[model samples]
Target: MPLGTLDRDPPPFFRQGPSALSKLAVCSALAFFLMVADARFKVMQPLRVVLATVLYPAQWLAMRPVLVFQHASQYFSSLTAAQTAQQEVLRKHSLQSQRANQVEQLSLENERLRKALGLRERLQSPSVAAQVIYDAADPYSRKVIIDKGMADKIALGSPVLDESGVLGQVTRVYPLVSEVTLITDRDHAIPVLNTRTGARGVAFGDVSLHVDAMELRFMAANADVAEGDLLTTSGVDGVYPPGLPVARIEKIERRVDAVFARIYCVPLAMVAGAGHVLVLEPTNAQIPARPAADVPAVVPRRGASR
Candidate 1:
């Protein structure tokens, strides 16, 4: 027989325990008794407390990295949320500001239109209403373009006006638009009458001041002109209507050696950024020619010199 088939047993002298089944039964009974004793008499309570106290430091140390990672994640999340909220608030504030500005601009525009309409109605002139298209291309001259042109009966030398006074006169007329020369242009002049002292003078546009101003040229240095005086069209020029507003006396300067007073006036009309205006028919156009019998002599034409 093989050696593996023989019984493997310890010598009696060396044997010191019972069979495996008996040993298992004895261990189970001792475990059950210990459990009962712990439950009823609290025998292991002190040992458990001592073990927890001893292991607390190790437990805290083992969880340190997890706690740190959780806290970091929460901090980053909170920062991101705050930034997003701030951006949203800024966007809303900007939108409101733009809306408020638009509303204010619209209100001002509407007020101007209303005043212009009232002025137009009060004047009994044959006029055509037109809107400003844009400013003229000339940088050195104060001029603007209107939407009306020859097609709309806008003629040369026609007076244009805004709410307050004569803004300008139509200078160039195209098929669909017309160019207006403002009263502030250097080449423009208007005959004005002072309402206070009943004085007549010619107001020429002044470019030397670099401001939108006009000067009463050729007036005596000690003239009766005063500040705050109102100037209106004298109706003698056969262009602007009588009693129409032109400008107001803003400043007057009299020099010892000068022959004329350096009087500056501010135009009553909205010369800059005018939206709506009126184009009036030229006053000379409406006047009839003199009778042929009243002519002193009929001058021969230059081409008839042959």
Candidate 2:
């Protein structure tokens, strides 16, 4: 096999079918014609399907790079997304743990407060826990509905409380549902007293003008009340028992013409936003408490120098 013979043995480039440009032009013209035929009439539907079937393997081969890139990108994206979700879950768990610790501390402080006030240990009113289903239909009234109703012994005028403080009073009762009026409603009135100065007042909401705030009316202008004072039920009203938390005084103003000082309060408990609540059922008897002992007189100590 001489080199020259080998070179001449097979024509270096044997003529094949059509030239690349000619083949491309013919394919393009056929595709355009087919598209036009399909658009103009539906007669080419079966032909198009058969053509697609014949070209399926080539089409798949042409798209291999794109498919591979898509799959790889998706894998990396999924890994990053999974990491982000895991971090979010960890952060939420940490926040919940912190909240739990704070709740425990608040419970201890509340117990200490009850003991110091010489106030009878407030009997934990027996309550039926309920889940809030929905907000009141009427926008004018600040009310909510709960899952527990007459079936659970929940009745009208029963006080509802959350973990933090008092939420509202049940106004309506149904077979399996109950409606509660938040303390922030205009028509709603609650007897309240200042925890710091012992000043008594009535809390009323003006639904027509104010929604988030309540008014404490009939407070004396010279009353020793201040902002941030905790308002509690005076128990004067037969409806709500005494010493129940009502609201926290946020602002106080005295006007020359007005006879009483104006006090605004924000409800301690979020009645509208709460998910769970306790319906406190009234008890027949008062809470039991030990009588206070009299203070003994102190004698002066005898000292040698004196």
Candidate 3:
């Protein structure tokens, strides 16, 4: 009985449906028809849109981590670049500020030097240009030290002048430097003539009374001196050249009890702040020598008395 059941075909309940070749042929034909319909009439367009809309939330959720990582990296990179740019701008600003200060200082020094050269061209006497090194150590006297001395052929008693007018006279000479007593020094005196009235007087430094002034010691109370009157060297002292400006009459006090009028004069030159000066040769050196007179004949004229 077991041999007969094994050889017979199975019942309909256990029979296989379609063969593999037949199912494959049917699925290929259906896919080809669907592709042709979609190409000719867009038959699946609505279905595709519905499917994409349904899957959109799932696609977005899957990409969230990748998008967050890209955004964070970009933010950090931009922040670091901004900080570097700010530091570069600050460094450039500091460098520009230092260059501007150097330019300003150079401009001022150039101006002062130009003015000093101009003064040298206007003088008539043989002169040597010198820079004021410093103020004299003696506080009681108004004096300054020049860079030039005997080595520069600077002679004692030479008149010194600045751009404005007479500044001082060289009193002492050294190897590398010389000392000039300013016109406003207590020990200095100058013979000045009034340009307006041609009045001649001796002007002495008024250090005891004022800082940078001169005094007309013994002028008459009714003298022609007045305020704003210009005074120049009279050339009688044999030190300074004639016609050089010295000072201006600032104040004149006349009193009945006092015999002399107190005249205060302000010097024209920048006595304390002069940076460059001109040292002029003494007037005596420039003056021509006088010729010797011819000796009188040994034999006197017959008409002359014995």
Candidate 4:
């Protein structure tokens, strides 16, 4: 077959269709029109819904692995963060607890110091502040050893006082320590004046009932003693200072047949819990010496003249 006679164009059955640009332009115009119609007239909305519903299961299946991977990563990260946050919270709580304990201890110590300072300021006589060193070795007597002694000028029979009231008296003074016999001791005694009635009475430590207490022995049955009466030192013994608190009347028993009344008193001082005390000079040492003019002259005998 001659080259010119060969079919340059495809036979009618195999003829080319419209150009790609024409097809593209027609499809774009149709797409624009459809979009406008959908926007304005709700055209193709039902079709879109139907297509989405039908393809939903396939889309979900395709996204499952990606969603799972993201969820797993997030879960691990959140777990680590939660553990860290818990540890931080625990650490903060521990620190706060420690600080609270320290604050409480400091508050208690400050209170004790304030009480001690106030007691020192109210005292009239010279005093040396002393701490309780240890309890006395003799268990038979209620006695305590103080840190102050002869080295600190703590004299024998010196009055000891706490913040509340009189505690005891220094009985034995060593070079560095002194032993104080508490007012509740079996051998201790103090002359006390009734604060409410102004009646004088001698308070003696009594241990007859296996309990330490002060008793006003020999008081008349009709005495004006009553419970809750405050007793103060009378300063008649030349040992304790005047106007110091001694004890408070706890009980009073008066029988019709008995001549004396039984009065029990509780000491105001913190005998068992006293941590610090004031040791004052003996009141006897403060007494003025007797004047020479007050001495009486001896009388001469007149028998020789007779």
Tens digits of per-residue lDDT for model 3, 230-267: 99999999989988899998999999999999999999
> For residues 1-306, could you state the per-residue lDDT of candidate 1 as single tens digits?
999998789778777779889999999999999899999999989999999999999999999999999999999999999999999999999999999999998898788889888888887678998999899887999999999998998889999998889998999999999999999999999999999999999998887775788888889998999999999999899998889999999989999999998999999998887888999998998889877786487779988965
Q: Candidate 1: which stretches are off by over 4 Å?
A: 1-53, 150-152, 255-259, 285-306
Per residue, candidate 2 scores C-alpha lDDT tens digits across 2-87 of 67656545564666568899999999999999889889997698987999999999999999999999999999999999999999
Q: What is candidate 4's lDDT per residue for 105-139, written digit by digit as tens?
A: 77875776677679778777788999897898888
| lDDT score, candidate 1, position 10 | 71
lDDT of each: 0.91, 0.79, 0.90, 0.89
* Candidate 2 ranges beyond 4 A from true positions: 1-123, 207-210, 283-306
lDDT of 3: 0.90
Against the correct fold, how does model 1 do in TM-score?
0.76
Worst 10 residues of 4 by lDDT: 205-214
- Quote the lDDT for 69 in model 3: 97
- Model 3 has a clash total of 0
Candidate 3: which pairs clash? none
